[model samples]
Target: MAHNQFELLKQRRFLPYFVVQLLGAFNDNVFRQAIIGLLGYMAIDADDKALYTQLAPAIFILPYFLFSATAGQIAEKLEKARLIRITTAMEIAIMTIAAAGFVTQNMIVLLVALFLTGVQSTLFGPVKYSILPSVLKPEELTGGNGLVEMGTSISILIGMIAGGLIFALAGAQGPWVAGIAVIALAVAGNLTSRAIPPVGAGAPELRIQWNPIPESVRIWRLTRKQLAVRNGVLGVSWFWFVGTVLTSNLPVYAESYLGGSPTLYVFALAVFSVGVGIGSLLCEKLSARTVEIGLVPLGAFGISAFVFDLHFAQPVASMAQGLTVGGFLAQPGSARVVIDLAGIGLFAGVFVVPLFALIQSRTPKGELARVIAGMNIQNALFIVLAAGVGIGAQSLLGWTIPQLFLALAIANTLVALWIFTIVPEFFMRFLSWVLVRALYRLRVRGIEQHVPDEGPALIVCNHVSYMDALILAASIPRPVRFVMYYRIFNIPVMRWIFRTAKAIPIAGAKEDPELLRRAFEEIDAALADGQVVGVFPEGALTRDGAIAPFKNGVERILERRPVPVVPMALRGMWASMWSRRDSRLGRMRVPRRFRAHVEVVADAPVSGEQATAAALEAKVRALRGDAA
Candidate 1:
């Protein structure tokens, strides 16, 4: 049974891993923020402070470039539970070295410790992502990822707060306090890692690669083998690029543009982090417990809209002195700015969770770790580039923070459009989802369990409305190649969507005999390739709100290629705007009253040999009941 993401916390396989990851993220931020705080606020010399503050992030990110390929190979070659324990132990050792640096107040030692922390994180990256598929069922991947993302975001916010508060309050003894906290967290992380249940090596026979460069190239090539995986990797990396730009600019933006102090900056961070957590939690509900990439487009649209709004929300001039968090909140337009920031974070959460889940769900288990490694490398490169661009824009071009936000808004649109063009399935899914969500209150029963997760199957449903295929496509968890009437498939706005979705367009025998033959051949090929094919047994929508007789075409289809047939029905759709409840041209035109309640029922799959059109039609009618 599907349960809330939080319920997984009670399970043995997920809870320990979740705690370890949360601690790991917390520890990273605490150290990083403390180092930055030391330079930004405590350092006596301006030049020394500026140089190290800039160098800190670079040092942390460098290991991902140099060692992630080797990390991926190690993860593939070793047992995941043992690997996690080893990496957590490494973190403990790194924190101990860091404590020595803090005690001596030596900058060089501290920098070395920072770099080592990055290396530890690099070694753990592949193991963290690749282990989920090994331990989780496919249907659980999205919810699992949502929890991980939510936990990581909240941990970062809390860790930064703890580091800043402890360091600021303790003064000279700040490093000592920070040092103890880091070591304690590291030990806790290690202990939690030990509690994770055992998982066998994903690729035990794989040979270890010693050279990072060639191995990185090899892994990048591996990602290109599947188009969906490649697109997913690119999407995730691009998200990092955009996110780094937005987040890294926050403090400066708050001070210069928003006329706010550090407290206000912290408030902004909290809002954004909480918003992201909220959005991540909402994915399971919005997708109906499925990993629906349709949400990706909605996310992208929201991100662009909110970011553009942020530019306009900023004050025209910087105040003489920054305002406190309370003062900032007292301003008239402050709430708008908060909404914009929260919206961006919320949409970002919506955008990223599914891409990560999709990559995990689609990638081959044996090579999943390496592909994730490749994605990490790309993410590193993009983040570095984003930093450079930010620096160059501010330092060389003299652009203000609002100008930067404007540029990012424009860049987001172009990037999202390019990615959607590369993967039309995302856009098609988006259109289907929007149509269903806007026009109907959709409810479904027995879909997740009965629908085949993978493999060829014939989906037989009663034809009720012209929008039947889109509704089914939106509701079902898998991508279905709908066998649709040629004329209906070519409907204006829906035509391109149908084409992009690869919906098979067929005509009746008298209308176009060649198209009929070709459609059947294509349907056979799709089934042979292990894809779902949906068909309306009645062949056309009923003129009245009643079940029509099943056609002989369904019998012909079953005889050609016998596959399991699942019976489904869309109820209460006959009165929908898209249906001919009145007339297609008269009162029931393009836009009727929206949000009509509709229910779809899916019954158990029956063997293909026994799935005659008459039997399937009767099943659908019974399932629909008095819905019309």
Candidate 2:
């Protein structure tokens, strides 16, 4: 119930991790940009500069492909806190070697340093992400990721500036400055890692594997076992690919396409990074602090739309030569380009944060690190493929950068459509989120900590409106199966959604005895499989604005399967357009624009043996109180 994420920074559990990650990100950028700057401008002769600069990035990324599997295994097999400390120590040693490379002005040594730094990051990757779920509660995961992402963006921006400044001002002393700065940051990171609470290994008994390729393949196979987790990982990897395409081409886009200077390029990066930070921070607010997968579709749409728009936003009048930062900003139609870039990053943040949270929450704890390792490998592969696509399009096909952006936007659309089709639950959740947000101003209380995060349970609620099931489905963080009257469940407009949610539809025993019997059997099967099933104990929708008498069907369900029953109440929905308060035509007269207040309060769980139909009806009425 904290108002903002900043309060997390004041606590020991999150603060130390935050500081360590921020510092690590800053160090990575500082060393990388510094090395790239030296290779591009100073250390290498003009003839060889291009080759070394191109080689630098490859060297940095190679470890992810070669060692991510082993790194994942290491994280799983060792205590996380110790692994973090060891990774931090490795960082210090790597930076020291980098400093020696800088001092001796040896390009080979520096490249080796880059490769080793990449290895350090490869090892750190699994630990950094896997530690989050252990350290933060389930509800806190999204917010924590948002903060880490924001810090990383800002750190990269600052590190780039610092690297640039060191190269410019330190002159011959640049190497020493870079070396000292990285070493100091590495030490600080190590200290911060020390303060992290102890985290035992997730898979301590697992045997270590030395072969990288087969191990990588094994882990990747494991990752693909879960459809949702696989899609989420693919989505995350695709984001990196799109990002690589954009970032790899930005300088060319600035200098050649937009006719802009280094200042202008930096300005563009700043806008994009800041936009991502803002969007990441906004996820908690938009989803009401839940891991709302609905935001993924929205974000994908925004990214596609803005990227497509960027193709047309290019200026008509060519400058023929690059412009100064200020000159570029002053040009006509430049604002649109800036907006497009920022929007791409903003939507990217929205797209990425939830997938990470989803992967963490859904993956088994034993395989969490290895799955993350697989994701890293996929991300690396995608980044390389993105580079290949960029090269083939621009060099082989003669496409302009704007043309490439358009192509990527189209590709993004296809990828999103494909993923959504493969997993319709994502689409269903998106519709549920939009529907509830549009019609009602919803307030949910006690579900965060009270509702079992994983288990079988029964939810008993007053049947107030046709929207009751939809509202509960949207509000609860986990998937829930609903038991509803066969007529309502089979409504032509809503049947598909009901089928998608796997809601069990029942008829009166006298009317359709077989259907009622099958419904109860299905409910029992669902509970046996550890799924939540929600039942409106009233057996039918309330005809008047009062709680209907609870039926004995709940008693039968409890007798069949003795699980905990949660009592809930719906308030302020009786007069909503979905309710049957007036004539059918009268109810549809005027649609509420939005912001109609409604509240769903869940009481503590009661034992199934003790929760009689009358007692539950009375409990729901008390929970509803004066509102309805």
Candidate 3:
């Protein structure tokens, strides 16, 4: 509510999901690292050791494919927060089983535990994702996702390192601290879970499916119907495919080619996680207030660049043996390689956060959990594909680690291309990029709560700055047609901006009254067709900082095709560098952060007649609240 970076986290609704997911990632890596480090390669044949070691990750990702659809249905039937709490409690026992396997040195039990952990994660799939739309407004989805991505990556990296270090140093007793830590994290996650507001499930009467393949296919079909949800699933799948390759093979590169101890694996993972966290945080900042998807492509470029550099970073000669963690850091040329790996992770942050939020913001109500389950199913398929590709490339194709990495990077580009091309809207974000770079980034608070995701609607906001039209065009997930003053609409550089957005130009009754009529007709057409029509009720940017009186034009337009009317207000824009008052005289007077603090707040819709000047002004004032 504060619009501060920490506000999203401090809120109880988001925190529960955040903490539970973080703890789950921590537990996963902890168990994985423990089992991975416990390998007795000397006891096994050489061929069997490689297969067994790789099997650990394969077992964990398998259940997401097998059970995500069932978990999604269960989430729809049960109370989500309570269900999540039970799942968290179950994690405690699951990790206890993991501890037993570690203590007994029973490989089969440990593998089964890996499978169980995967199943637990699969159950978590829908609750983790679907809950966001219920708790946060549309605008908040991007920031909330940014925080979640940041938390998950940081936890995984820290968890893997801690798990490996504890197991290697403390032996059987090592899992004791890990067990206690994991259970506590899960408990903490559950405590926060209670703070979340309740939301009912969609299609509660729908029968649950026992079979995953058929059910996954069915859910996948459901996801396809929702464009945004479909893209979300694809993006999540791509993430797993890329992650699987990097995680599965990097250990071999570090050990066999780079000639390093097990610590090198830690180093590789740490670098990647740091990159992802940084990229995730950057999404909130780069996207401004709403979900600006342009950054996804920017992240794609970073992935290609650093991943390519990493492939080429390999030395022609072998390195010295037995490098400690510190020694690895101290090695010649190691720093650049580490930084490159970290860069890959950072951009991954940018790539994934938006896609997740896009799904949350766009999925149908009550079905959020089911859609998340659908996403998990896609993730599983990608992971399996990643496994097959990794194995075949390394064992059959005889590709070197560096060559394999290069191929993966190429694969990333191809995958991104395929997904974006299928869903052009993701790449249709080019307009967003143009708008942000053209001026300072715009911020909005609760705007999404105001705009109806579907049905007919008219949004009336008082225009203040020249950039108002562009800002409105860029931020809203729904494509809108803004009614702007004809004079500015025809200006050379400004004309292109208006043209790009397909804004309708209107003049006052005293000047080109016909254009005004045409504008109303257009608004009518848009509303009748169930699209949003955005208009500056004053019919022009306010010459004064205070909102100008609303014109009957909005009332007239609404009368023609009466629909829901949503009111929006822009604050701090009067002081923006692009404002009329912010001409050459005031250019040097504004503070640096002044531009950043401006916000557009949205209020709930009112009836068309109730959208009179006085009523509209009151709504705007309410949205702005008391300044500061």
Q: Whose lDDT is greatest here?
A: 1
Q: List ranges where model 1 is wrong by over 4 Å.
A: 37-44, 134-139, 199-201, 552-561, 584-593
Q: Which stretch of 10 consecutive residues in model 1 shows the poorest summed lDDT? A: 584-593
TM-score of candidate 2 to 2 decimals: 0.96
Quote the lDDT for 502 in model 1.
91
**What's the C-alpha lDDT at position 409 in model 2?**
97
TM-score of 3: 0.82
Q: Which has the higher TM-score value, candidate number 1 or candidate number 2?
A: 2
Ordered from best to worst TM-score, the candidate numbers read 2, 1, 3
Instruction: Please give the clash total of every predicted structure, in order.
Output: 0, 0, 4
lDDT of 3 at 54: 70
lDDT of 3 by residue, 489-597 (tens): 8977777657655688989888988987788888788888778888888767767677777777877886677788888877777767566766566454557424445
Across 1-628, the per-residue lDDT of candidate 1 in tens digits comes to 3466778889998999999999999999998887766654465598888888889899999999999999999999999999999999999999999888877777788899999999999999998899988887656777888899999999999999987787688888888887898999999999998899999998999999899999999998988888878988988898898888988999988887778888878888899998888888888777766668888988888999999999888543245257888788777788888899899989988999888888887787899999999999999999999988998999999998888889999999998998898888788778877787888988888777688877899998888787899888867767789999999998998998999889999999999999999999999999998889999978888888888988978788889888998999988888786776756455754444357788889999989888887888899999889887
How does model 3 fare in lDDT?
0.75
TM-score for every candidate vs. truth?
Answer: 0.92, 0.96, 0.82
Candidate 3: stretches off by over 4 Å: 41-48, 172-197, 256-259, 314-318, 441-457, 462-467, 474-532, 537-552, 560-607, 613-628
lDDT of 2 at 625: 94
Rate residue 277 of model 1 by lDDT: 87
The global C-alpha lDDT for each of the candidates, from Candidate 1 onward, is: 0.86, 0.86, 0.75
> Where's the lowest-lDDT run of ten residues in candidate 2?
586-595
